[model samples]
Target: MDAEHIRAIAQQTGCTHIHPGYGFLSESPQLASLFPEGGAIVFIGPSTGTLRVASDKMQSRALAVHNGVPVAPGAHVSSAEDVHKFVEGLGSAPFPIIIKALDGGGGRGIRLVYAEDHIDHAFRRCVGESASRRVFAEKAFVGPGWRHVEVQIVGDGLGNVSHLWERECSVQRRFQKVVEMAPSTLPRDTVGHVIEAALKMARHLQYKSLGTFEFLIDDHAKHWIFLEINPRIQVEHTVTEELLNIDLVKAQLQLSLPKASLEVVLPAWTMSPQPSPPPGYAIQLRLVAEDPHKDFRLSTGTIGPADVFWPSGRGVRVDTWLSTGPYYRGGLQWAVGVDFDSLLAKIVVHAGTFQEASARALRALRETRIAGDVKTNVEILSGVIAHQDWSSGRIYTQWLEEKVDQLVQLGNTQLTRQSRGSLSDTAAPRRLSGGTESATATALLQPGASFQLSLSPSLPQAASGQQTQKHTLVISSIGRNAFPNELSGTITTSLSAMPLSFSLSQLSSIMASAHTEFANPADPSHVASPIAGKIVELHPALETVAGDANKGSYVRKGEPLVVISVMKMESVVNAPASGRVVRVGRGIEVGNIVAEGALLCVLDVTDMDKGLARL
Candidate 1:
């Protein structure tokens, strides 16, 4: 919400009460305090002191340990001496120790201590980060495996508290939860113990309002430790809402209002009441602008030609901040600006089975086209869906690490197919007569060599440092795409054969001759557009750079003809190796499209003083 609009709304609505969702203004006691003073709104949350206490990672860990809640072993250090003091005691704990910034969470201020020698470097880095982000450190949670379990609780104004069932949020990437579902995969007794600890913590602080206590469950399922508590609504709150018919937001408002009466509608919380896994399964894939496979850095800019078709049959919900119209109705127009671009557009899908839902969502995501500088990690998410581990429900917090290469390949493949308009047609392997293959090979290469050959700008060399420069380029079996394992030995070249097996290096290095025919050739000024789109820039050099044809006002063929951009692909057309500038036109941008050989700019291939020969 914008500033002016929010203020106007506050004025009109009388600002009786405000409940900022989690990660927003939810835990801001200072902002909450402003409500009562302004005599307009009331902030619904705990006291300012409690907010400070919960926000501090070290302080919270100490509290949890003091209250008999198990926590990972580690001491909060402030400087180098503090680290020296604690390092001696960390006997046999393993190599990868975690050093997290006290004030930071959500995987931002965290580093892995890979080796003993790296501890000092890791410690110093964390200290600097802590000072900057106002955080401290504790022993990182290193175990066989980690499971994120969260419990949502509501407190009555009179100090009565109740715990809703816990949700297992173990599926993650970059420490951010991607998929969360109700009824944790942990044991029933473990869930009870965590809930008991959570209630104790809440009572100790007298926290009144909606809150969630987080815990890290180790691999053995024998040990569960309290991590900390999120003082506001989380992004995954929908998971709990889906499992339980209760609206947590409404409950929070009622509980915060002192005069509002309370009702015991939900029965005393029981573990078995989690609704038997909801019949089918549901998964929410966060459509983040930033690439998870690419360091998770913030990727900003507009998403053009944005159009979304929601699945409305049933069991599907789309929570997004996207719209369309003349502003973005055209095929490749920008929808959002650079700012507010990094946020996600979440797609919640549900089906009778996990596989079905995942497949449906994948299809929907790929079919829709969202162009512009703002790139989404839709390809990565699809890869996860297709992965055997993910599809089989064996996903873990670090699953993405093992599948990084696969994700990158999938992303690049999608981008290439989309750009080239090759996504539509899936061709079958063509079968050529043995004689035909032999004849084509003999025709296109030197004596005894098989196939036509042209090297691209980049010639790929093998690990042996040997660059193959022959008609039938040789490649390792692995580099050849879709070739049968049996034929990987030595498949002779065949130019006429379709779906030919070639290495990526081979394809990229295949360049047509400079004099390759363009069907209807023209002079420098007669030469057409560079890109496959409408004109965008026509340099003034058409006359000066290409001299004059008749009265020196004419262009001396063979120069930068013109610039055009189609489907976002841009290039400047120069004389077909050499030509003269004849005609120049207006500029073009994002929305225009051009045919194979449409006359965009004209060039004259004539001999002049400033022509190719002159150079």
Candidate 2:
């Protein structure tokens, strides 16, 4: 948590309090303990003791059991042998078991092992992703009917705690929450039991500040089990705030004050034994910068000023730090890379009814327009919101991943309709202030053309008669034609005005150069990295034949060759065919960052049919 650096900064700025603002060191015991009681700076979070137990999955499970809470059968494991033994003990309980990092949260260090053959790989991956290199095996509650629900609790570190209702976080991908809503649809009695259970644990620990107690519910069995407690504020906290009309962040800070109590810091109504139901339902959709079509790979690039248009109006809120302008000029500089989170924004909507909320969310999503080199999960969010299953409340944690293809199709259709409507609305060609001439007049737009446009807009004359403020839009290279009605090339720009118009033919001839020249489908000798990330693991098969073209190691098609970690997500690069490794890419090693399309290996395939079949 960089205690020395933080202390120095606080001393230099004369600050007395530090709010971790969730993630990173928000739940770190070391961070909280760094600033002792009555120290120069106070950490706005739970006590170090609380963080120690809550941050470790094994310890938290023990605490839950000690407090008479139900937890799934699990055991801390450090090796694949331990996982195998644990699975063997399960007997016929279930084939798929979940492996979780002992100190992981925010759905980062988790893997689902579906078969005995995958146990080792899944275990190793979990270890690699974990900060402590510790993992555990547990009985997984697989389902089409199971739901993930959590209770929002606030405490004053004095054994006084209050529940702020529950949230449904069932819509997820890769175990990470994608959509969250306040006021779960579970029966009132069931929700009451969860709230009571959460409060019981909070009171037992005297948990301070705001935290979320997560639980997994099996709808078919009418059963539930304690998952784990998030010792700090959550990413989906906005939905709860919108539903309850309360400021959780403010409450968290106030609770951090000495002598603060729940009764003193919270509303009188919240102190009731049975607080009133929230006024409305609220839903939050996470907008991540990823390409859903490519297995949700993390996308990195600049978003032009005209590339992103956020939605607005009543009952809607968009929270984000993304802006499309130069960093020094007070614009948001996108620094999302292998080291940063892919979350770009969160769109929250509140309405009187669930259906109304869903409709409003869809409207807001449709109104949002994000273009340029950067890809986002807006379509995925739209698909989940518009699905019949989502509208009917028939969703679970795996619902999004299970129906991702169908959802993507639906979202694309909706997007196409919206695009058509927008095109019709702006059928007339607009003129720039420079002249009536079309921006595409001088250029013979074609694939691979090195054409660029720099617009120097004439700003109003200053009192000192300074030169007009100018903005530039650089178009580097055009590759292939795709969108006939829109310019398909990548534009590096700072202009926030309407996009310049181009003829259909001209626009059709434009494409980003980066999208050109993919590996030929007919070639099976080469393998490339599908995304930009750091290589975290390499298969032993490659090592056996490294730098020895004459001595190749045989590998089956679809076998994992390497694993890449990007933005905290791991993706496996598999053998492209049933082949022998001639050689791996020079300088390819674990911990090395690789760009998309970078060569990873060269395979001499012996069976083409096997590769195609695997695909």
Candidate 3:
């Protein structure tokens, strides 16, 4: 909730407490400590001091260092020149240097600078992501197999701090966690170190309610470095709850409420004054509405009727905001928007052994179906859990990046051919008679013109490599899930007088297939927009593209030429031909509305050297 909204609602409803759940005002120290004139509502998390120190990445790192916790070697640089000078002293290190905003969390406002050429762009991008203009850098824990381990610590506001084991959350993409598991396979001593460090931090801060102390375990799994403190309940809190049988939210409320003792709530506390030892194994997979094969781009749409099913038996749970609804038209609909986190739901499973829990999770995922046109990461989760590396516990942060191709293939297997048998079989396209003028909607007919056109098999095969098989597009950036596999009338053709009505039978027979690859690398003939959206980014003069290294030079295939965004889903338009960009759209600027199939630029196939000779 916004700060104004929260205060207004509290005043209006006479509410005395604000539990922000996880995001928005949850971590805002200002909001947590907000004291309007005569307004006194308890913020159910931490004191202003704890929230303030833990909010800044640099400040939290300092706290960890002050508390004798091992931290990764890094520096806080706020400017691009500072970054250049910082990297210069590193002396040819192969590991990527990480740049992060001082006031960023949840993996946003972060960048991994792999090479010198990318530093300026990454630095600028990171700085712009945060409002504070304070960015920092660190040598990334370059991995053979690094792990993300964070301890769950809860405090009772009176310096009586306790930790409930650790969670392994290494599987990530774009520096954000996608899958999380509990009770890491780290040696007991390592786990002890993580828990001890967490308790020390919590005791020092006198933190109240639920919070997390994140860390980075080195590739060999020997060294551990304190990362940062998330002073709120996390998205993966379910993993810890399922394994430890403790309700963290309840704990938070009890601790935050007036005069609630930790000992009274923890009935099974042992003689050591700590909660009973943690038990069992658990894993959680975040079900996000994005195409992992297409770089995890957001798929915002009103999900159509889906035959939903949760895993059977015990120790399995499906937590989602989707309300109960029928699996038919005119029923409960999930209108997925781009305003919040892409995580639509989470599948949490628990069992006595890690292998048993993993097996159950696989079964659950296989049984689950999200039907309709929304692209989901369910299959990707399925692939990761069932992979051999995950079973052997030899996984790391970059493991998914390395095995993305195979994992995608594993996911693509779930897309089997489904019968699209409609109202009638073999029905022709509905005809619209216009005084004996046989016009086809699909033909190359201009305004007020009519002619017959057909897909001729005898035409010369399209320029070396081309997509010959016509496809019925199944989900789109704009249309949502209303008409699955129906054409949206986006075609680029230049001929005269031909139009025909399209048939549903033909479209259904065309079948639904996902071309998951990022851009068809096989050179394209024209530069066109694939979807109706705004042109978010256009290229500068291509010096390396042309042979002469001149401004606005030619480019080879697969180079990023243009970028278009529709409803927050961004698609990069690559050069389909090895040629110089001859013509750019007159008003092609950032935020300019563009129609699908609208030509953005024209490419001249003539190579620069040959063109120079002709000149």
- Highest-scoring model, TM-score: 2
Off by over 4 Å in 2: 324-335, 419-522, 540-553, 607-615
Error of 3 at 258 (Å): 1.0
What is the C-alpha lDDT profile of model 1 across 1-615, one tens digit per residue?
Answer: 343455458779887776666653565555555555236666677656667777777778877988999887777776656665565676765445577776555554566666666666556545544434343434566433667788887665445566776777776665667666565655677677788888888877777777889998775656778887778777776656654556777777766665543354343443332332334455666777654544543343333222233333455566765545445444442333222334456666656565676675665555544433345777776666666666655655566655667865775564344344423322211223221111011112121211222322232233234332323333322433332111234445443322333321111111112211122332334343322334444455553433443422233334444544322223445545444444432222223333223344444444454654444
Ranking by lDDT: 2, 3, 1
lDDT of 3 by residue, 1-615 (tens): 478777788879988878888874677888876743234777888887888898888899999999999887778896888888888877777458899888777676788888888888778667756657798998888566688889988777789877777899988877778889998876667677788899999999988888999988874748888989999999899998898788888888888667776676554442154443466799998888777755676554444333344455688888976536464445445555444567777989999998999988877776555543346888788889878888998888888877888877775564332134321222212232221111122221122211112222222343233222322233334433322232354446533233332222111111111221112223354576554455666666332333232334556666667766544334567777667776564445676655433456667776566544433
Candidate 3 lDDT (Cα, whole model)? 0.67
Can you give the TM-score per candidate against the true fold? 0.59, 0.82, 0.76
Runs in model 1 deviating more than 4 A are: 1-14, 36-40, 116-133, 186-189, 261-280, 292-296, 305-312, 324-341, 351-369, 407-615
Winning model by lDDT: 2
